[model samples]
Target: MSIRITGLRGENRIGDGHNHKGRKVTSAPSSIGFYLYGALLLLVCALKIPALVRRPRDTLLRAACLLLLSAGLLMILAAPHSIAGLNRHSGIANVSAPVVYVMTTIFSGASLLLIINWRPAPAEQTRRLTRLCLVLYGAASLAIVLLFWAGDAPVEQRTLFDVHYAGTPCIREMIVLYLGAQGAAMTAASVMCWRWSAKVRGSLRAGLTILAVAYLLIVCFVVMRLCAVAARWTGHDLDFLVDEVSVLLSAPAAVLGALGFALPLAGPRLAETVRAIRQLRQLGPLWRALKDVPTPGAVRVPLSWWRNPPAVLLTGRKTALYDAILALTPHCDPEVRDAAHAAALRAGCGDADAARAAEAAMILVARERQRASPLRPPDATGREVRHAQAQDLITLSRAVTSPLVHHIRDPYMPLQKAANHE
Candidate 1:
């Protein structure tokens, strides 16, 4: 006996494992796609669950998390083999059909709730609309269960039992009810996300735009399923649309939806981490120069600094550099700074570099002066001294390592020592 599989455009008869429609039906790979998509959805749920637990007081976030988790669970159970197993274990003929239908309806409702709660809506209107959606989908689910019980069994046992029973008395109504709910939910989600995407910026905007596209795909999936069912009613077969095309739409839709939701929360954190690393690199020279002077309250080098720089270590380095600059303020001499500026200019340094070298030379001289006369009165010219800003620190850090500034620091020492020895 030949098995008849319907395509969107034609019917194909399969008897000797050959396709008459010039295309071979490959259901196995599609089955694997379903499993992979289901796993991805579950992984998203796993990652979000901890945040939900940590922020239990955030009602909106909690609601969205729970809805996403419910949708993921339903998707896992609604996979073809999984649903078939559920039907076999239940001992009810074709029971998985309505069970899967109900699950899909709930999943669609949950997706709608997630999007509604994720973006702000007026509290009173949102609450009322949420309640209405819950009631309507709840009624639809109950109606599907009742209709499944009342409908007669199909002649053929198929994985997509809904398509086979699409023309059955109560089953047809059940299909219409569930598909209508799903289509309406997806349409609303698409429109809302599209509108909101325009108002947001950066990662949030990208996420919203992606979410809108996912919803549009879901709408397409719902439309295809509805068309397949309608074909059954009109004595035509469009089983391929439901079986093949719908899965193609759904897998990406689910994956993209999960990623879209994640991007807004995770994107900012990733960007922050990257910025911190960049700042650490830029501040390295200033931090190293300050470390060499060993002022009081300077942070000790962490064992891991050379191997792997932690964020806390970077923060400590910044703080220590600032503190060291403040500690040296009392000993900064204006004469030393002026001499260093002239030396740097004679050495062909640019105006900015000369200024920076003068500041660096003054800081080095101040450290020496403070060491030589620990109890000296603070210089009147240095009374208004303040810690350098980050940019100034960076510039001074470069100057401190330059040959010109180093030569200026010990200009008379070599000549004076040689004359005394002579």
Candidate 2:
């Protein structure tokens, strides 16, 4: 068949099994791609659900869920089997084409809105931009559907729909329509992310940088397909562009885009978990030192976590330590604290270190007295509160092992220390 374009006539020689470069076309990978993509997105949705339920106004997570879901659905529908199924169900040839295009357009707009939300702006301006994106993409999606209805595509195409029907009238226009919308969104997101990356720091900057690269890769895919479609207009075949380059490019782009979106959200939580684990380990000595000081309803179990999350485990440990300390308040000796303070100062300790040493010394004495007395002490006074804050808990915990505190804890050390002070 000969397609006439630009006042010239040439053969439409685009083959079925192979591209212009004589390489085999493979789309089975995209079937696997959708399963993996969908599973990952579902995991993300699960993670966000708790946050969204707690705060119903979490627009960022909502936008991200929409973007990822649309992207996964688009991939699924792009598979040849899925296309065949849709065509069979709808009783329309190549019917999956418009639905896939509409999904891609929705993903494009959702991605742009997500990027816009990442960088804060005035609420009114953000809303206006969001509405504009939705309207523009909505019109394009509607046009794709209308053009599909208007176009003549009796032959169902599982793969290569764009290049396969490049010569057909309305299908040709529909191809350009969807690609144009995708290109515009990618270009806008790429520029916005590149500029935004330079102005931010840490995870946000890294996420934006990765997103910028992913957008460029997506643009490359679009451009390659557009070029092949344009080549068809001149009655030439460059089907290799779509079959080879564009399809290959899409895999990495999708992976990188998912990582880009994930980094900013998951990075902080990851860091906090690490910190909590580290602090919890450092507090082990202090926790064991209070083992004999009975905490009400405390069980003597192994330290290994049984499905306890890091943050929760750390909080519970801190609460238990404080409760044990409060139980020892009646045994606290002021003389022991005073001797530890003088010893710490004489040892060239700063005010903070001296205070921690004194507190540690008194805690050691109180714990020893509680252990030797054979009976439980009364609960703490009503007006008394926890003496240390969360941040100080680690330092105070380590101070239990300090030489100065142990020195002052000696029964005879306080008399000499008091005489020296006088």
Candidate 3:
């Protein structure tokens, strides 16, 4: 909405003036674009609402939601039927112009505010800049209302207000004011996005690129619409610019704009979900081994914990493994670990792999001992077990199930029973 006539040309078309000469548009966008736009807006709103509810104080999220809602309402109000209904209710000829223009200006301002909030900046500077935008756009909106009152257009031109009244005194000033305000915002947004896209990567970079392209299209639409209106002053018939050319630019811009905004938020989240699922699967064996061990500190991860963020699920899974390990620390026999480490190194495992194998051997034996005699007196004290990382957990999980750990579990495997104690 942050471009001149792109916001104004919702369902408008050329008047039957002397200049309605270009071939009519295919009308596909005219029929389908609005519905697509509405659906996308609803989807985006639904996506953002959950996050906003979770973090009610997020300024960026609030602005984004406001911007989306404004865009949806602007389209609805500027529709042909909506305009005709507005005119009929007010009993005024072309009364919808000021209303639609004001809404467009509001949407343009909201878009600018959202972008400013999105980029990283000092709080004080961002606040000052945002305040300035509000003031400037607000003044322009007031001027639109004032000029609409001063202008006298008794003719009811639903779709051709700008073109039909191009030379009309105050209405021309009003059109130029709103267009200038909206165009300036869109051009600024386009330039900002183009420059920022270079500094980012992945889905965010692509999203910014899409936004830049969409804003540029709006700027071009505005320029073409301005030329169309100005041509009426020179008595030339370029009304075809608005009637035929607008759909091509504005429809695609609307779609790209929505995609651009949604992708940045969705892409990383999707990737994280996949990673979380993989992590859960890789550690399933380790989790199953400790399933019988009562959790230390009475901490229990809920079955519905997966509904939380991926990080939360990952943290919970890792913590459960370590908590169960710490509970088994009193049963850890260092000689058993040393014996397994030597056996693993003898079997061609690298030092790190041998250490992981040795740790898994001790854990497998401790699980069995803990279950076999939960009240056994402790021989080991203050044993330190390292917290498991993702790759380490995967390797350790596999090692725990390996034949080497099974061999270490045998009672007659030359395991020392604290013999030669001083």
Candidate 1 residue 395 C-alpha distance from true site, Å: 6.0
Q: After superposition, how far is residue 129 of candidate 1 from its true place, in Å?
A: 1.8
How do the predictions measure up, each by TM-score?
0.76, 0.74, 0.72
Candidate rank order under TM-score: 1, 2, 3
Best by lDDT: 3
Q: What is candidate 3's lDDT per residue for 1-422, written digit by digit as tens?
A: 43223223333333432323444333222424554565567677779899999999887888788788778767766665566678889998777889888888888888888888898889998889888888988898899999999999898765556778899999999988887877898999888888888998988999999998998888887787789899999998777676567646866888798789878989898878888888888888898988678755758857566368766787788888877887877777777788989888998889988888888887777776676667644656566444322337778888878787666556413234323121
Clashes of each: 0, 0, 0
Predict model 1's lDDT versus the native: 0.68
Quote the positional error of residue 11 for candidate 2 in Å.
20
**Error in Å for residue 128 of model 1:** 1.6
Reference-based lDDT, each prediction: 0.68, 0.74, 0.75
By the TM-score metric, which is better: model 2 or model 3? 2
lDDT of 2 by residue, 1-422 (tens): 00001101111233474544466544343356555656666676678777778878776767777776776566666655566678899998778778888888888888888887768788888878877987898899999999989999997655567888888989899999988888889989999999988888887888889989999988888888899999999988887676555766766787788788779888888878898899899898798897567866655443457687788889888877877777777667667787888888999999889988888888877776766663644653431234532336788889988876777777633354445545
Candidate 2: residue pairs that collide: none
Q: Look at candidate 3 and give me any clashing residue pairs.
A: none
